[model samples]
Target: MYVYDEFDRAFLAERVAEFRDQVARRLSGALSEDEFKPLRLMNGVYLQLHAYMLRVAIPYGTLSSDQLRRLAYVARTYDRGYGHFTTRQNIQFNWIKLEDLPDAMAALAEVGVHGIQTSGNCIRNVTTDQWAGATPQEFDDPRIWAEILRQYSTLHPEFTYLPRKFKIAITAAPKDRAATKVHDVGLRLHRNEAGELGFEVLVGGGLGRTPFVGKSVRAFLPARHLLSYIEAIMRVYNQYGRRDNIYKARIKILVHEIGAEAFAKAVEAEWEAIRDGALHLSDEIIADIRSRFLYPDFQPRADQPAALATALEDPAFAAWHRNSVHPHKVPGHAIVTVSLKAIGAPPGDATADQMEVVAALADDFGWREIRVGHEQNLCLPNVAQEDLPAIWRRLEAAGLATPNVNHISDIIACPGLDYCALANARAIPVAQEIAKRFADLERSRTIGRLHVNISGCINACGHHHVGHIGILGVEKNGQEFYQITLGGRADEHAQLGTLLGPAVSYEQVPGLIEDVVDTYIELRAGPDELFIDTVARLGVEPFKERVYAAH
Candidate 1:
């Protein structure tokens, strides 16, 4: 966690004051709805279908106990008693009143959290692996670089308003937990043949009405020149990215229009001119950034805790451990992922009390650190293995311990017609029905490591394009219909899904998903093969045939 300095505090205060004045003017009729749109968007406020929504940025999904508590307070006081954690690892309060926004902003600023750059065509929250510093297989912590990039790009004069919103993701691990390939700019930190660290940069990756897996622009960008190289890419996009149509404004569209090779050539030419400019990251600056990040203190202990063996005797504890617990860099320490997707509840929402419970657990057992994963989950990145049983019990009591991390029931769904004004249909109820359909833990585990993502429209806020099973809601002839896609995944080998067939009625979606799962089971080599692998091995034909036939 990077603590805010005097300058950071001062900047947040000024922004809050400015926004307060803006809101007052809007209420006083000095600014109309159209006039206040951009100003409110710049402050991360959106006028949704029902009311105003405020999205707060959780940089790289990292938060301290104090910050978490402050978020809990904001949720309790300003809006409803809960907040939705989004796919981009940010939190949104759906019921926020426009008049109370300045108070909320000032309260969040006290803990170094704000919603700036969370909306309007600018660089959004920079995200990375939630387990960045604690994971064993990473080359180095990516959050250090994520924080550096955040400071460099926040309110940058040149990129304040791009043709469209841009996103950047970085990961140091070979296993891409950050969904790097589907971002506007994705960076993977890897060592070259000569053992020098550098980035493998991917440009033009995005999902929306048009989906694309990014193309590799630079096979090796030295770590020292990260900012300069990214600046070059931004310059190229700013210069040529379309502004005429909102649908074609994204950098992904620009890269698609001109070939990727041509885009790379243009970026390289820009890089050649500015690669050694003041934007270059120096050793001292990198070190300073690294030093600001808080790290856990690990103690020597047994590889496997003795109590863990006893805890496994309890089937509930065993299930949670198998699904939610992940390996950590330090021995006798584990990373605990808390699933917010409980049974039929809205995915990624945490009640104010639940937030406090997680914060309390982090303070007591997790070295006072918490992380929000892009999967709509919370993580205690450094929990002692011996304390696993106690943590599980606590989580269970709080309704935060759903042992379906990667299973079928752990769905990713956007706030469709329930919240968003742009949505054509409701997504939350669709996700809820599917979750209820697969509520049996044993049956879900049998289905195995499946991702089900739903979006109300083509905006793709739920990341429906990259799920193993994607559901897109559409309005056809005054009726709600859902389109299904298969075999998409967001990882090192990222690819967009293939549509199975024409859209089906909303009532047919759950049964359709069940038919697809049953088809995978019948066609899979064995229980060892995942749904995604089976879909990859056999194309979408088998599942598509079964699903349509069943329908």
Candidate 2:
């Protein structure tokens, strides 16, 4: 993890002091709720239903062991003894007292973490593929660029109050695990034909009441121009972004209203104006930032191949092999995703003790590195392949071993009624019930790599709009109802889901999901075809016809 510099330190200190004053004023009734709302939000404080929710930025999902320990301390001391990791590679504490928030903020600042840019109309946390540094296919570590953006965007005076909140995600992996297409701005990093690293810039992608998969504004943006290009985009948004209606506030709405070609032209015009500004990334600056991300030492390992062969024999290890593990960049190293979706537990709630265990696992197993994936899972990037069984056993004992990484049961759901004041229904219970319905490993694995996202409301916090099969909870006659949609995805070929049928009762949700899955099982070309691919090829007709079938 990159350590904070004097600049970063000073900025955070000043911002914390500023927020301390804001909190004091709000408490003293000097500022009305409406006035305090935006100010508090800019500082990453939210007035939730039960208590103030504080969302701390975990940039690009990279956390040092020390940072993890501090997070555990926050959970233990201030809030409850746990914290919730969110879908966009951030964490939220649901139980924060206003009185203790200042102390919490100071503690967080001590560890180079903060609530700034975690919420509000400025650019939120710069997220990336959890596997960035350790992945084999990456052109370069996207986290480097993400950090650059973090410094540039945090409390940026110009974009402090944009028309709406902005989000940016970068990924260098061939696989689109970060769902770059569904962000306000998405950067897919890759090397060009000449082997020069660059980015594919997409703008205006987001999901709310309306959803759009952003269009490509620049196909090949060299790394040095990253901040310059981003500045260009932000300037265009600030200048022309709509403030007439909150619903149309997002840049996605702006991108839709103005075609991609015209938007690109506008951004290009702005890019030309400030191409060589102070924000322009120079080689010396890049080298300094890049130095902080130096790879860990790896001793030559002659013992790895045989160890991996030994791991294949254990059934439990084999189960993990088929699920939560991936190939790593190092010779004897393997990528491991520590599944947080254990049965009956919240998807990403790691106990303080468990957090410590993860820290230990990262330290003892490989480099002192850890990654918080966008899918609410943790990634151990360079574990020795030979120790797979032992690691799996330890994770199992710690309740961190659930072999359902990309399988159907590994659903991504929002905190919903459990945490959010904006939610209309309880997504956790519904998700839990659906998990129960598909608990059979054989059945789930047979279905394969399906993303089922559930949102409690149309705000789409759970990203249901991008799931292969999406579920949105709504209130009908004061009763909770769920609307199912099919064919949605957030990869390069991103598309919002189309509704399947009328909203179903909460009681009938599991059955409806079963019907949809069953229909996919019947109509899919083969077991190899995942739900999204099959749905795209076959359309939603089969699933819809079966789900809403007249009995």
Clashes of each: 0, 0
Encode model 2's per-residue lDDT on 258-335: one tens digit a residue: 899999999999999888888788999998888877577876665457867787788877888879888777777789
Per-residue lDDT of model 1, residues 104-204, tens digit only: 99999988889999999999999999998899999999998899899999999999999999999999999999999999999999999999889999998
User: Which candidate achieves the best TM-score against the true structure?
Assistant: 1
What lDDT score is found at residue 187 in candidate 2?
96
Residue 158 displacement in candidate 2 (angstroms) = 0.6
Highest lDDT: give the candidate number: 1
| TM-score against truth, every candidate | 0.99, 0.96
Q: Please identify model 1 stretches exceeding 4 Å from their true place.
A: none
Model 1, residue pairs in steric clash: none
Local error of candidate 1 at 203, Å?
0.3
